[model samples]
Target: MNQPVSGFSKKSKAEKIEWLAENYLQNNLRSVQVLKNYWNDDPSLQQLHDDFIENTLSNYYLPFGIAPNFLINEKLYALPMVTEESSVVAAASNAAKFWLERGGFKAEVISTEKNGQIHFNFFGSEKVIEAFFEEIKPKLHSSIQAIEKNMKARGGGLLALSLVDKSHILEGYFHIHATFETLDAMGANFINTCLEQMAHTFEEEARNFEAFQKKVTYPEVVMSILSNYVPECLVRAEVSCNVEELTTKHHEGKHFAEKFVRAIEIAKTETRRAVTHNKGIMNGVDAVVLATGNDFRAVEAGVHAYAARNSYYSSLTHAKIEDDVFTFWIELPLAVGTVGGLTSLHPLTKLAFEILQKPDAKELMQILAVAGLAQNFAAIRSLVTTGIQKGHMKMHLMNILNQLHATEAEKEKAMEHFMKNTISHSAVVDFLGKLRL
Candidate 1:
């Protein structure tokens, strides 16, 4: 029965909320109250959040936490994380502590290249189009001089340009592919702007080309945009220690290392296992990506694409035991930036950067890779040892308790009881029911 309302964006916040409440929320007063309750108290701060997007509603908050004692490349750091998952921060902190004594984590940036494309339709001879592209390639670079000036001054700019003919895949399809170095910024806007300019110039030049005029065919631009699949922007992070040093109370070092390597191999070979295995890695990767105000969705897309680059999806993390040493590492594409987008606008994001010691884009990529590696190590370590449920459910207990509306005394008792007993939603409910009785 809800009807679309025009000019919703121009409406005041209160008006928008009222319309939404009436049209969709069934006029629930409690729902309306809930929306207002989450609004920031500080007027300036609320406005800042409001300006972030259109039709601002109440803020949705995630817990911002710190995983301390991360030693990457001989430098100590405490990573900032934002996630609703109860076990993520606990798992990351545990992994950081475990690796701290194992010579810490080592990370390095392998490359920093991003690219975009200008898709156009060229219904003409391929040879003529090729010749025209070669002649105009230099002009394509020069067309973006004004746009690339600032980026070039910072030691990053257009890297290369090429003509790609995909008429075989889709008839009359061709594109101008361009590569770039965005430096410290995520460079999405910069790259996109440059692409738009080049696209404009490309279409303009096509009209005057002798071949196009003679053949009565023109290259019609479809779109110009940057690609999120940045495989060339990669980082590798790893941790290694003697096999004997992996010994814990539950398992011997040799057995544990062998089992760990086998688990990773299973993930690599099996798609079902690989999906969940990679998801655990993202639990860590996404937390830091969100905390630092980078686009987690973009990072996720690019990373998953990389995992499937070999024609099959596999684990992002790898493990090996050689010469009495167990090494665990992950190499993935992370096209994140430290100086632009929400990184500067969001207060918590800014704080996250400060917590990370203000790393540049490359350094941030290393940190993100290390976070994913640490998370995977922790998850696989648990899966091969205590079983994932034991620690994960224990961490999830607080959420269940909060859901059941347990009081302070009840929560304290529940924690102690679950520490000794297995945890499940029904079990927690039963325990609280008995305690209340």
Candidate 2:
């Protein structure tokens, strides 16, 4: 029943945005079409649209919100995800519903842990710096040891250190990993500050090298950090529901689980299947990343690189039904932030963050982890039984017909559920009756 609207055609840009937000929340399904018109008039909206285009790298993008309708473990989240892959949004939304039908998702997050580095480069003179490197070693040892005195006193210390050369030069990089319990912070700024301190001290002490400019690589040291995104710290959500609630017809969940495992195995082992499979996982991860203003690109890099570690390039998650029950799970290498950078600059990102109720990074990561698992759950659940295209094509058809500018009759022809039929362009014309969206 969603029709293309023209009522806002006359409104100013700001008016349309205000109207779009209200109607979008109200579930007016054709808000996307309305958005195009609004974007034409509004500079701010255009900026958002442009940014999205750059971020997603696709001409096609869709945004939908996942509300934790049924919550478990006393947690509620409005998960927003954007992706073109079919079934992703529906799958995640459906999975969350499955959990919510019980008590809702219970999520426990480990404190955030950040690692910093100090890259030491011997620029001018190697001989002086070589002797100073030895002196600096003892100083570096004490400095590192003394840096986290209070943290060490609290039983968390500089976890470890590694020195690696950039190329042939003696450009050694100190790999510092500090595990902290950031109860509710993003820790990027905090971690960056910590790294800055080390870099400064390292620079000053490098003066002992005299002629050689032995300095700590500040920019490189803090460049792009690698997060300690332990999969265990992820939001683990479990649900229990009467079999009757899940389907119109009764299904033995255990059998479904077995099939799910096999499907996942196939998905991971096969190269083509794995692309779609991991893409399914990103359905959840990317959405949360977009909402949080985290770099989805970086997230994608880390996840894919990690996925390649075993040479098998396997799936990131697994699911099964056990003992008349259904359980779903996914593990992720998600490095996201709750503060700084894009989160602070983007308007929609700011609004989305507020909708999340300003959760600390730990809580935010939990939300993302759950979304990834939930999305994966949606994909495998369909593939094991109905097949992926069956459901996906349903939505795809609707979108295609809309784009084709089809009429009510042609739309109904495609919508007919009992029989599988294709509509020709001629048939579509016969059905056309001054159609609207």
Candidate 3:
């Protein structure tokens, strides 16, 4: 039987580990050792990691890799990627090199607007609430001035405040919808702070107002939070070249371009294919987002919402061929920050920024968008020509070798054999068996 324990967080790291091992792990020494093995060698670094979250045990690691020769907006970058997938880095690098010989990727930040809400329950007259909102709009901005001081000095802060009436849809539901521009920061904390302050001021001021005082209808402040759906904080990245430039090993340039456009059209019409197609794009976007220590989850949420913005989910990347030129591009809402949070805290995050030449928020947005575009191009290229599994299974060979517990000599022979032969689990196993015999 499991039991809840109080003061669990107050326990020391060793004590917490011991309790977990004893209670849940059945006192398995190997399990305990595995956790301990992942701890940082330096005590200070271990402490820093432990402080990052609650109930810290040991660090979970993902492979950090680099895809070089990415030419975005006439500048070169070696994009840092952190992922567990075997083929993502390789695919991104292939696309980067492919485009490098042509014109490279072009990227731009379309907007930088973020939003939040102060949700509340108001049972007052609709007319009264609307008039009150009009009166309190300026005060809402004034209340959060102290919080916005530094953000404004950097040319980023609260931009607009509006009252939204949702009482018709959901009884007594009203909100203060606020917009912000946080510049280089992701601005979650900043936007939420302003929202909460504005909410507090609204409630306090409403109590003193004559209509509210006479009628005793006080709006109940429910919550204040930032929205991850940042449709306005968008970036676009594209790669374009003459149709002749799209020639690959297996197909002529014009034929390849025709097949590629048709493939995108299928993804646009089919939900199942669109889901996987967009997921491939995120493989590149998320890798860079993680390496740079930005919020990949938030980026994912915003991007998927944008995909379904037209009442049906569809491909994030689009392909077109016209005037003897083939173009492939993606435009997505990515609200990621270059500073603050893990970017300044994690050592590798600092290194990632240095490798990127210290791009600002807009520059980082552009680079991330290009990463996604490159990844999609590689995936679609593979799908339209040689098929996806050939490369994917080849890249997955090491994982299979590790699972089979093959020796160094056996792995070397297996690698050589698979280079000339098709890779499959049964094939590898049979080869190993024959080698053993």
Error at 294, model 1, angstroms: 0.6
For model 3 the local lDDT of residue 21 reads: 84
Error of 3 at 354 (Å): 0.6
RMSD per candidate (Å) reads 0.8, 10.1, 1.1
For candidate 3, the 10 contiguous residues with the lowest summed lDDT are 242-251
Error of 1 at 335 (Å): 0.7
**Model 3, global lDDT:** 0.93
lDDT of 2 by residue, 1-437 (tens): 34466765566655655565566546464654555543435656556655643222112335646545524357576776656655667777788877676556555554344455555433333344455555555455466555556556655444544443343534443333434433343445555555556566557765444445334322133343435443323344334444344553435555566677788778768878888788878877898787777878867876776666687787776555555565555556555777667777776688878877787676777777777767777777787777777677666666667877766777785578314644444444444544434
Estimate, for each residue in 126-222, the C-alpha lDDT of model 3 and write its tens digit: 8888888899889998998899999999999999988899999999999888899999999888888889899899999898888887898988899
Badly placed stretches (over 4 Å) of model 2 are: 1-64, 67-72, 102-106, 119-204, 207-250, 268-272, 320-326, 407-413, 416-437
Q: Per-prediction TM-score, please?
A: 0.99, 0.65, 0.98
Winner on lDDT between 1 and 2 is 1
| Top candidate when judged by lDDT against the true structure | 1
Q: Candidate 1, which ten residues in sequence have the lowest lDDT sum?
A: 1-10
lDDT (tens digit, per residue) of candidate 1 on 1-437: 77879999999999999999999999999999999999999999999999999889889999999999999999999999999999999999999999999899999999999999999998889999999999998999999999999999999999999999999999999998899999999999999999999999988998999989988999999999999999999999999999999998889999999999999999999999999999999999999999999999999999999999999999999999989999999999989999989999999999999999999999999999999998999899999999999999999999999999999999999999988999999999999999989
Model 3, backbone clash pairs (residues 3+ apart or across chains), number: 0
CA shift at 210, candidate 1, in angstroms? 0.5
> Residue 225: error of model 1 in Å?
0.8
